[model samples]
Target: MSTIQFTFAVFLLMTCSSRVHSQICEAGWFGSKCQFQCHCTSPCHSITGQCQGKSTCLKGWFGNACQYRDLAHVSSCNIVLNPRQPFSSWVTDRNDSTCNEDVTLESVALSWSTSVPFTWMRLTLNESVILRSLRVSFTSKTSSNATCIDTKLYLINNKTVDIRCKVIVDTTSVIIEGQGVKSLCSLYINGGRNVALKQNSAQTSTYTSPTVAASASKAVDGNTLGLLSSNTCMRTQSSDTCPNWNVTFDQSQVLTAIHIYNTNDAFPVCSGRCGLQLNKFSLESFNSSGTVFRYQDHSTTFTSLYEVTVAEMASGIPVNGLRLGLNRTNPILMMCEVEAYGECVPGSWGLECKKICADRCSSQCHVETGSCPVCNDFDDRSSCHTGCATGYFGYDCSQPCSQNCQNRECNSTTGLCFSCVDGYLGPDCPENVTENIEDHLLILITGLGVGLGVSCAVIASLLIVIIYLIGRGKQPLKESKPSPDYIQRDSIGTGTMDSHGYQIYVTPVRPYQNVSNTYIKVIGDAEVIQPPDTYINVTTKANDEHDDC
Candidate 1:
């Protein structure tokens, strides 16, 4: 190195070394760079920079410095149960989980027409949610009419709570169960905000299916019962291969128990013949990924339902779907329902969470499988904190029960049709008219048939009588009259045989006995002549055989 450059380099090194030794961390802060915040009640040690008394970093912040960073938010006990998260792969919640939505509370109430104006409204949330507060609003005319509003909460860990408050009018703020909860799934509000809201309750449901076999089903459709029994219950395929039923869920669960319902009243005889009544079957549960857990069962009681506890779970294995198989499907391998108890699927609430709930439902139904961890009855899958009220029916609960219906109430599913009016039929109840032309026409047709049959019988008898009269007229009757003059002429007659085996009669004439005036005489069928009456005897012969007879 050059002489001047070397001297400058040494000076720089000495200055940097001195500054490094003199620098020290601030109070409540420690680290080589002096950036860490400590969790100390008092000042930290000067050399080691350790907290003097209390624990390091109050729940959130870490390191030696009291940085006021929230570590608790990061280390919070919220274990994400949704395996489909990071939200990219899911339909809901691509953004953060906190979705603050403003919704119209008008549609969620259970409503039906009544003879009396019994106006009430209700609202239920979809999934269990941590409640911040509730905001209510009313119009000038409605606030005076509403009676009360009720609320229900379903915690994610399977707990339920209720709260009710009288409507004090205007927009009132209320707290539901008053606490932060473990993934709350549902909320509810009853009684209308206004009286103008007179309409039928909507019962809506949404399904987040995973390649369901609706189109792939062989027989016995995939409606209400298809989810439980993937196989055709009453029918068998040509090949006797054991049909396997499979179901896939949206997330994984730690399975503890299972329930299987066989083909019930549907095609009872065919179910028996087709092996719809299960004898020997095997079940396999799969995780969110395709890993599996297996079990086997054999019974002969012909039960419609079967419940079994999982033998291989202390803490339980994560499961998302199940595979049911049969050893021999003489008729068919069939089931009516399949239920698994495990960690609840996300976007679902209440018990085992098999219900299809969505914002479309105006009312929700309480599920009866397990203690609700999060959502309440019929949660709205479309809206996390939105769902139909209880006892409402239809997609948006837009159709109401009949005004004449009892209590103005109807089934949430079947609606008023379940207990329809006296003269009504169908789900929508098109009126039944009293005077029916079809009945009259049927009666007329029957009368015509009877008249035609009677006429045919009478005509046949007349034809038979006419035919007898005509045939009798064509025949002649015979009557014999004896010839009066022939009896006095014959003296004696003799019979002779002819070639035709006919009898001929002969008569003898004596010459002295009678001589005609001219010595000639004619008889009936013969001519006789004698010569001059000179002792002549002549024999007369008959022209026809009748003369001999």
Candidate 2:
């Protein structure tokens, strides 16, 4: 009992206590006491039970601790499995949804003489399941040299995963083909489930009945029994207006399909139970961001389940709520069950919602593919990512520009033309100004021609009148000579008369005032002419009063 012996004993005791406190559990289990099971899409942390890397918890489970579970999980244990080829002895009852302990398939050894493409033992699941990863054990009963076996995973989402050994799995079923191996055994899945199971659900009105429980939550209770005795169907209150049923998930989810189990009660079999009232109903999805996405109308009458697939997830918004109602006011609405299958995590897409979207993706990425939804303009509807081509504009580039547009070019968003050709005007280049201008010119020319014709006619009439008056005034005067007594001649030095003056004759002028100034002496038919010096251009009367001597 020395100081050294006591100190060593205390240290050894402390080491044993620490080792007992932190005992390790197997791969899929974690907790302070190593008691909780993990269902992460990726590997879970040993201490905290959280999903590691960039992965998330499987659908129906959430939170940092991954302890909270929702109703979205649908187990594949009891689902039926059928082989693609009938009468194949390879498949048996052991090939059910639950992977058996000793189930295995045997294949022949690889050789050129053997069948070229080996046959695959394909099994189709009666119900689809969302899958993350799958593992299958392989063994050889004989000497086989193949190190790897090929496996194919087919999803109900129309996607395929082909890989070697343990890899990414899919929904619905798996197809297996052995290489040079002899046997393949037991299947194992990591993660996948439904997101809308047992979530908060409501309807416009519940049926007022004392004998039955017909609340809206009955539609999503994972029960498809349509009988009235089962009491699993949801019945709305009878009214003249259409009734609506909605289910809201705790978190946003990207959905693939929504299955509605129509009412099929047998006791008092009515038209509603036969899915007559289920026809002509529409489905709408509400996103967490307050956006509602609508689907086309459903008109088919089914005896059992009717599936509606929401294909376009390009809007990028994760759905939080779903609404299903009749298009017409059919009095009452009765639904046996409703199931929604999809990924519950946002900002992630693709198989199992395991892939993260790119940073450049705006709003939301497509659920199947990580590609962003772009090309809102008309030019590129199929990922062209360009503006609308010439002569096309508006959404989807379906609208054509006006033919009068110059070079057939216009705004890609709006149909407004850049410029009008020739005489066309306005934004759409629909108005023609050339025709108006031509019409005005024709009117002006006609007016000018009429005015010129009238002016010419008036001028010609005035000239004709002037000519007639001049001719009437110029008519020859009556021939009358002065009387013989008036003729007197004198030979004076003053030269008043001609030198030889036997007789003098004077002629009168009329109209135009020009007088004859010639003096002639007549003696027995002989006439005498006046000298040049005595000749004068007279402008006076023809009578004697005009004479100046």
Candidate 3:
């Protein structure tokens, strides 16, 4: 090989090695080989394939690997429509699987106004969501044809879509319109779960006889059969003055509307009046506090409506129970089925209550819309989070922090200062609690003086007791045996000597009486004057082996 060829070969090898070593995957790609697609809401780690950023997987995706998808959540959605046409608002009502294409007595349908050939309905969502598929069951003006010919969905980015068409796009709002759309029998966006399915139910009185019985729970049994003989409808006893029925949800629910399927008893015995008897009734909702809010009035006369829809109050009322009862008069009330559809309780939103409310919301949020009724601050109207800045506090952050607060820092929710300045006290730091330092020192000195006086009194009492004991004279000393060669002295001693110059005394040991071990000796000078009461003399001869004193 030539020199130039060898150098070129080495450089090419190094370049290839560098490129291979720095092989980085794109944003959506993960795994060691970068062959797997990330299903996270943000991005995933390139090597471990774990969700990054918030570490949360995308909607409907779960598990540590984010490989499994919850089809039930991915396919469920609630429609929020802003009607631009004169059509009734019933078009946005949620329907269950029991509803079919045909407009039956139990199927609620929205009829399009024939005055407008083209109609548009704009959908508004609380947050941006992935668009799945739109399901609209359009009925025909005639028996053999479909009226909705040019049904188109307008995406946020000005993209057009067809009915029931697959769409994977992030959108906050969309417009839906159809050319020559005669009537909408049923409308479903993706799919939604019936939160009121098989919930607890009760009525004022149940119709009971020897052959059959109808309870309040029958209305929520997911059966739309309206026949009286089917035993699936709920009926109140005829004797009850005010027939009433209610379904209490296990958890609190924020309902937008409720669909009531009236019993359509088509029998020869009852002339066309079975379904008509359900008229002149009202639909009401109540919470645990017994606060009732009527959603539908008793004046409604559904001449041909076997399926009645009661729209809830604005902002989606949070309720635990729904009531259906006669108003102003006693009438028989019977319903085959009832479905209350909306988002779950507060603190949660979205399908199956999987989405959490924004942490900024000081109070609960609107169930479907995720709007906070009470935001933490006022600066950011779009969000409940973003609490008040350094010097601001209170609702919407309108109020300023207290002047007494140190550094002007206070609680955003309560508008109270976290800590007060030197002299101020309390949450708002409004009360002045400062006192003079000299007064405090005076109190300390007084306390110390009292303590010293008490200690001196105790010491004086102890000294008196000691002096009295000493004046009573000393007690006798304890005696102990001494060695033969040593003299033992008693511990009790009087510090006084006799008038005599010297005195000597000897005493024999009483315990040692054996003649071999006993001896005594004493010497006093004849010149020394000895007091007879204080002196004693003794002599002993060792050879005699006897001693006396």
| lDDT of prediction 3 | 0.48
lDDT of 2 by residue, 64-139 (tens): 3454332112232222222222233222222333322222422211112111111112223223221111222322
Candidate 3: regions farther than 4 A off: 1-193, 209-211, 266-272, 295-313, 328-330, 350-549
Name the weakest run of 10 consecutive residues (lDDT summed) in model 3: 515-524
Q: What is the per-residue lDDT of model 1 for residues 429-488, given as tens digits with 9 covering 90 to 100?
A: 454423333555566666556555555665665567557656888443223232343222
Give the lDDT ranking, best first.
2, 3, 1
Q: lDDT (0-100) at residue 313 of candidate 1?
A: 25
Better of 1 and 2 by TM-score: 2
Candidate 3 residue-wise lDDT, 1-549, digit = tens: 999999999999999987676667777765444544577777788756687665666654443345433222322322333333333334432221122222222222233222111122223332221122122333223222122222223232112111211111122222233211223322323222345666789888888656557888788776776765688888877777767788887667655445677777754433455777777666666776554445434444444333232221222346677777774444677878877754465587643355677776523443334554433344564444476788886445766888998899876645556777787666577766545334555666665565555556656655675566567764422333333332311111121222321222223212211111001100112122221221111112222211110
Flag regions of model 1 displaced more than 4 Å: 1-236, 265-277, 288-291, 312-315, 329-331, 345-549
Tell me the deviation in Å of residue 499 in model 1.
99
What ordering of candidates by TM-score runs from best to worst? 2, 3, 1
Q: What TM-score does prediction 3 earn?
A: 0.35
